[model samples]
Target: MLGKILRIIGIILMGLASALMILGGIGTVCIAWFPENWESLAMMAPYKLIFQTAVIFTILAGILGFWATIKLARRKPNGWNMAVIALLLSLATAGTKMYFSNMARGSVAPTNMRFYFSLFVLLYFLALRIPAIWDKIRFEGDQPDEGVGGLAGGAAAIVAGGLTLTVHLWAGPSHTVNGINYVAYLQTELLAAGVGLIIVGLIPLALDLWKTAVSRHTSETLKIPVIDNRA
Candidate 1:
């Protein structure tokens, strides 16, 4: 079970991290280079470069997180340490962006997906270190099928994709930029979240299906050795 859980985590982090890296990089570049053209971005004109650097760090942290997850799947000794670093970096990035963005926009609260997921995953790691919980998780660690995780991961990806899209649709195209730029509605965070989920979900889900198919094919085609005892 632990093994399968590790694999699922690996699949989820790698795919999500890859997607975030691409999107975050592009967004940072766009914000820095074309702040004037965007109403929301324009607000950060003075701090465009700052936000860009923060975003870059976030992307780097995500990459490290991906590497850490891979190491964990392989049962590397330093996997947890590396994960600690990645999660801290991610938390720092989230805090920095939220703090500065809120100050700039005159908002008291601001949040991002990175903030929520990193914090939760990190907390989970801490909880696992407890002897009692670790016992349960490791009870059937050596058992096969451990397949509950794979199914859960797939179902979660689908559900996340569906919910995000639903919210995006429900929100409609009507975003407000400090009482201005109605056009920002077309480019809302919900829209980005929905699209990101769809794209990110495709990676792990496709890989899961592909592996299942190959495994089935190999099982069907493989020949077993047989011997006959004759008098």
Candidate 2:
């Protein structure tokens, strides 16, 4: 009964996460892409490229999250793995946002609340891995869990970050296109470099996090029928 309750709560949290990602991504893209007036224009002019790139990642995460949620609802085999992915992406973004925002403000007292909230939810998600919960959620099928086999995301991040930094160097600090706020580091081409590095760093960290979370209670230790959740 407790497992069932936790499962229900997890689904609700998952759905909320998906909706927030989609809505927030779209809103940010609209504002940054179409700056309505001078204030909005000035706000996004410097870091528009970063905003655009993150927006792409955000939308993808949201879509995958929704797909995974549907799969879970239907007890599909791939749902477990997909949910892990969606949660990882969401964690990456939340951490990056919190880091950059704190850096910009030069204070950590009042951080982006999403960071803490996402982390708590992530831990809660991990706690739901009890065998009883898994017995309820896991369907009989192939568990295509290749958590360590793939470096594609990390390699892609490296290339993107390297290219961004290269562009930043080539741009030569001349007005950040010499059009808008060309001088500020946080608001100029430098921001792209920062965001790019964050992406590069976070991918592996998220992967490691996933590995650690799923490895906590193996069949050997739990003494039950193992439903491999490492994906």
In the range 7-125, model 1's lDDT, one tens digit per residue, is 45544544343334334444445545667976666786887777778778777876787566555544455666677787787777777777777777664222355566667777766
Best-fitting candidate, scored by TM-score: 1
Q: Give the whole-model CA lDDT for all candidates, comma-separated.
A: 0.58, 0.53
In model 1, how many backbone clashes occur? 0
Local distance difference test, candidate 2: 0.53
Candidate 2 lands at a TM-score of 0.51
As for candidate 1, its clashing pairs are none
lDDT of 2 at 117: 50
> Which structure among the candidates has the greatest lDDT?
1
Per-model TM-score on C-alpha atoms: 0.56, 0.51
